[model samples]
Target: MLETIYTENAPKPIGPYAQAIKVGEFVYPAGQIGADPATGQLVEGSIKEQAKQALLNLSAVLEEAGSSLDQVVKTTCYLSTMENFQEFNEAFGEQFAGHEPARTCFAVQELPLKALCEIEVVAVVKK
Candidate 1:
């Protein structure tokens, strides 16, 4: 069976979708941006700060789904510009630490809330 996951600790979806979903031993978290859970406002700052918040938001969603970044087997990241790739990856690496999950990143034309980056993960969880 599949289960939906959410938490007030993470930013609520601005659109019609759950923050994450769980099935069997896996959790798929929807892409997260730099919005704050308490205010629903995009965190204001550089790509580094926005990327940091996005990762934190993703972390909260995964936590609610009984998983963590360490368990993520794969991830997809979207960035607003290729120029900020290195800056985003530096912050991303700090968040993931040594647990580097297979990842794909792309420079997109735009993103929700005009966020600098958005990140989503596929993780293994103990169901």
Candidate 2:
């Protein structure tokens, strides 16, 4: 069965998309930027801080889908600029240190809310 996952703990979607979708034993969480849930605004700070917030947002979405970062099978990271890669890597690495999943990072032209970066995850859902 397929289910759409939504939680007020994560930032509301800015488009016509569910925060995440769970089908069978898998869940695909939409890309999440560093927007604060309470303010619904991009967090301020360096790329590391923004990246941390983005991952935190992603974690929240996964949890709502009955999954967690440790259950993630893959992830895609989008950076506004490659120059920020090193900093982003440091923070991202810290978050997924022992739970590293297949990952990819791309330097995108831009992201919603002028976010510094965005992150999306594909995870295995638990019963």
Best by TM-score: 1
lDDT of each: 0.91, 0.91
Q: Which stretches of candidate 2 lie over 4 Å from their true place?
A: none
* lDDT per residue (tens digit) for residues 1-127 in model 2: 8899999999999999999999989999999999998999999999898899988998999999888888999989999999999999899889887778999999998899999999988999765
- Candidate 1 structure lDDT: 0.91
Clashes of 1: 0
- Evaluate residue 32 in candidate 2 and report its C-alpha lDDT on the 0 to 100 scale: 92
What TM-score would every model get versus the actual structure?
0.97, 0.96
lDDT of 1 by residue, 3-26 (tens): 999999999999999999899899
Clashing pairs in 2: none
